[model samples]
Target: MLTNVAVLALDGGHAFELGVFCEIFGMDRSDDGLPPYDFALVSATGTLVSTRHGFRVEATHGLDRLEAADLIGVPASDPDVPQPPQLYEALRAAVARGARVLSICSGAFVLGEAGLLDGRRCTTHWRYAAELARRYPRTRVEPDHLYVDEDPVITGAGTAAGIDTCLHLVRKLQGSAVANDIARRMVTSPHRQGSQTQYVRRPDPGRRSGSLTPVLAWLDAHLHQPLTVDQMSRRAHMSPRTFARRFQQEVGTTPLQWLTGQRILLAQQYLENSEEPVTAIAVRTGFGSAETLRHHFFRRLGTTPHAYRRAFRADPAPPGR
Candidate 1:
């Protein structure tokens, strides 16, 4: 149903993210059985718009493009200077008519200003999540993961994550085979779960110490074994008290949280890529049991492992693929 798409570009446009949208959605992949999107860029005016990095884009269509669109994408831009009232009106009109909307990175600010994010579950770059939450109280802003696709409304983190979000929409509207083919051609991952942590912790003092790297790598390699924070501290040759502070600083999250996230990622891989039973997958992923895996999977992905696999799997990825 969402075969037509309109990408709205404004002043201070993030060219990389905008280009990601075009590359993933605008390119024709008809031979692969993928749905072709009538995708094009629309500006506030049918004129040239300047990007944050000093490049300019010439748009032939204005907000008028939204009229024929079944989906609309808004790429990141500087949030301080907002778009004009007419642009807001046009977006509101499109959503009112049931157009699915998506925002990449700071573009969430524009959607927020337009009131489209009101009472919606959305996410932006982790760096901007706090500010976005401050400005939009009605919206539940999640800072982690790659993206959030809440059916008709979707949002993503900064940079390459936009490509992931767009590919995901392609997957949703089209299907896994089509999405996977497009991704393969583009040299990108077709489906990186939205719940994966943003990245390894940074600026943490504990991990930076020469002693901790090997321990961390070892932990990564042996995740299926019961991992304890105390054991980790000893492995790093540090007192638990010092290790906790260092881990939080270096990773941007607590140790247990990071461990839990890693386990979840492993569990998800088995859920999608293998035919392992839930309990067996849980044990292999170090969650101990299916129930433990389910709790964390739901907390992180907003769905049970079984449900997620069933919805997104191309081949039935239950045990024994």
Candidate 2:
């Protein structure tokens, strides 16, 4: 029942993904009608930690917590410092004792370092996927997909995918309803991606002083409305032609495609978080119709909203299962 989940935090760990696990399990999700998880942050030292970003975090638990965990989470961390030997031994021992190990972003390196990923399938952030593969030649690393679960050991693709992976685990254990309930409370999606087609239009950003930060923020806030290159151009004070050319060049994606992805992301969030039904989520996310929402959600996430939610909720039986 996921009675205990231990998240390992070390020097230079990214707080956001660490916070992701806390959001899903560490917090009181029961207020949202979800199950409660016993969650704690553990470290090699059982003391306060400083991230690569300069924030300080204290974890009172030590490596002993790994022995009692149903799941062990490894969030993003700096690849510079290697994981301690004792920590690696603790991880190996935990998995040997049947505890599931999860890694987010560059945290894949931690699993690799522990020899847990040898001859197994895994993944990490796209930016460091090549390095992960190069470093762990015995492991097969998938560069796409939001997350890959090798049953006992799972790895998320990047920062946001960490949330998706955590929710996916909840879906696997509790049922779709519970996962959706927690996701809604967190304001995130139940399912984000499938088969890597949605990620095909990945655009590399331009490194000039003119950034798309403002435009991206605007798009995120106004995803419910119809957005065009011309409209976005006007908002950014650039001509339509210039904006289109530069957006494609800088963002490594078309404005339209990015907007569609954002809309899907929003729809996914609503589907997981709210019980208002697919039609309602469609309208709220600007999909216009249930049919449209169905098309995109299935195409992007490889499952329908109903099916996805059902698998992760209180219902133990999946469609085929």
Candidate 3:
């Protein structure tokens, strides 16, 4: 039902965020059997909008175009600058009529100014989460989430997470089959749950002497085997306490937390690409038992393994079927 799409082209907006919408919704994918959307770039301030990247875009449509759009995309721009009052009013009207609005990165601030964020949970880039919460006291700001879908107002964190947010909406309205095909065309991950953490820590390359890359590579290869902090610490040539402390500093999360996340990702891949039973996948992914795998799957993904497989597993049917 979400066929019509409109992306706002604000003055000084970030180009990448705007392009995310264009890439996802504007492309003609009907040749591949994917649904095509009626897409347009709408300018709220004027016909010509300058991006923060020193490029200019001409938005042939104006705010009036929003009236026919089923989804409105707001890309990242300066949160401190004020948007036109009419822009805010048009957004409110669009949502009230049952259309959805999504914001990428700092675009959540524009929603806040329009009063759409009040009494709803939302998120933005981690760097702007605190300010979003401070500005809109009524809304709960979750900084760690990749995206928060509070119905008609979804908010994605940072730049790349915008892809996750848009794909999620597509999967929800269309079907996982369509979303998965689109993702394959884009050469990106098919699904990254909204609840997944946005923070992914990597050790600085300059600090090679203390890098945990070797230890992490070992863990990745040995996910099916039992692992303990003591074993990992020995692999890193450090005492257990020292290893834990250093990991927290460089990884932004505990070793066990990171290990669990990796295991879940592996389990997801098996579920999506194979017909393996849950019990088999459990042992293969280091969960030990199907019950244990279900526990973690529900805790982290908010869905059972069976349900996730049903949602994401590729259709056996050929294209155009």
**Which portions of model 1 miss their true places by more than 4 Å?**
31-33, 194-196, 204-321
Best by TM-score: 1
Clashing pairs in 2: 171-312, 175-312, 175-313, 176-309, 176-312, 176-313, 177-313, 184-273, 203-252, 204-252
lDDT of 3 by residue, 129-239 (tens): 879999999999988788889999999999989999999999999999999998999999878643534143333334444489788878888999999999999999999
Task: Give the winner by lDDT.
Answer: 3
Give the Cα lDDT of each candidate: 0.81, 0.82, 0.89
Judge candidate 1 at residue 261 and give its lDDT: 80
lDDT of 2 at 201: 33
Instruction: Give the per-residue lDDT digits (tens) of candidate 1, residues 1-321.
Output: 768888987898899888888888788877876767788889985589889898899877878889999988899998898798998898889889999888998999998998988988898987788899999999999787678887677999888788789888878877888778988999977876535342323333344455456666777778899988898888878899888887877767888898888777767666667777898998998888889889888887766888767755557734764
Query: How are the candidates ranked when ordered by lDDT, highest leading?
Result: 3, 2, 1
Task: Write down the TM-score of every candidate.
Answer: 0.65, 0.64, 0.65
Model 2 C-alpha lDDT per residue in residues 75-137, reported as the tens digit of each score: 999876897799999999999999999999899999999999998998888888879999899
TM-score of structure candidate 1: 0.65
* Candidate 1 local Cα displacement, residue 53, angstroms: 1.7
Alpha-carbon lDDT of model 1: 0.81
Give the CA lDDT, 0 to 100, for residue 273 in model 3: 82
Clashing pairs in 3: none
Ranking by TM-score: 1, 3, 2
